[model samples]
Target: MADLEAKPPLSPSSTLEKQFEDFRHHLEESESLRERIRAVAREIESVTRLIYSCLLLVHQSRPIPEVLEKVKAQISKLKELFHRLAGILRECPGQYYRYHGDWRSETQTVVSLLGFMHWLETGNLLMHTQVEERLGLKTSEFGLDIEDYLIGICFMSNELPRYVVNQVTAGDYDCPRKVLKFLTDLHAAFRMLNLRNDLLRKKFDGMKYDLRRVEEVYYDVKIRGLTANGDSTRDLGIQGQS
Candidate 1:
């Protein structure tokens, strides 16, 4: 009786084809969305590069206010691109991470550029919230990932050894001391985290080298008895008399 009342199996020719056709359509839509996301990410990366180039003027000891102004001028353009990316991702609700890889590198680079800028302007680490706020990212909708932000910070640290060298050559002898302090504190803060990210862990390791370079610079300055607090005459006079 039970066997007689059982329903028939779905037709392989009709139902299977329909199911596969649905799968095919879904894949096409996802690919289309990914391409759109990639387009926006490319633009964002271009803008990030522009900002990074502008900030490179720092290595030349360019005026902080001027470098910052040039970088800031590009902020609105970045914000608009990010907004467009968010709009595209919104098509797939609750799936931001699904396509995260499509734009992860670009986002990390942008954060590094912005982090470097903020450090130059204020001599402080750019907090994650500040990144979102400055980029005009709606936190509840689309937010900056913590790992990306941390990785960006590591990139920013890579700039410091060169920066310290440049600043010292430019006669800012006291710069190394300040940078050393900051890097030391930053390194300590990183130690507190159990950084499991392979890239982040590697970056954190490189930061040690940055700290060491700054330390050497600071030591050289201190031992030379070079007064870097703008007392140029006294510094020269003491060195000459010695």
Candidate 2:
């Protein structure tokens, strides 16, 4: 008698249709956004595999200066692709809101997605410190500044929790609508990240407390829990450069 509340997952066809419908509605606001989304989707379909491979390498490798170099190279490649994508969008018009609506907004969206992935990448590094230390390496000397890395992590971690907040609290029609579609796409990427390595989700969960702090700072949202510190970071045994 307890079988009345199950929900079904969205079929692939339904997902595409919903995305297109949202695009059409958003296009009514700016044709450029519609065009840019299509362009980026095409690029994503083509380059996602490469990005995944790089991400996997970053996640799975032991800490060494060379590995950090490789990670930096991968990040540079990601940024180059994003910039090229943005150049295509800029050929149309206006500043990409990265936070608001318009044709250029797609760059901001892509940046945020990349940022989240990067943040997780770093968090993984910190979480695995003992492994790196065992190899006689210091993760911090990868040669990145705190502000730059922190901002990227903050931006990336913000995406989902912010999406959650927008769904429940925001009154802005356009912003919420855009965020919903972006959130769906981000989750799809998250699923791909999970599939690439069965252990990622488990490892990710082990660092959830740290990630939550990132999400909080990114969205300027607060939670009622003590922030993880000291042995909290060490107990996880994740290597951190800082």
Clashing pairs in 1: none
In terms of lDDT, the best-performing candidate is: 1
Give the clashing pairs for model 2.
116-156, 126-238, 126-239, 127-238, 128-238, 128-239, 129-238, 129-239, 140-241
The runs of at least 3 residues in candidate 2 whose Cα sits more than 4 Å from the true structure, single-residue gaps closed, are 1-33, 44-49, 58-61, 74-76, 95-208, 211-242
- In candidate 2, what residue range of length 10 has the lowest lDDT sum? 99-108
Clash counts per candidate, in order, are: 0, 9
| 37-97: candidate 1 lDDT, tens digit per residue | 9999999988988888888899999999988987888999988998999899888999899
Off by over 4 Å in 1: 1-9, 227-242
- Candidate 2 has an lDDT of 0.40
Q: Give the TM-score of each candidate.
A: 0.88, 0.30
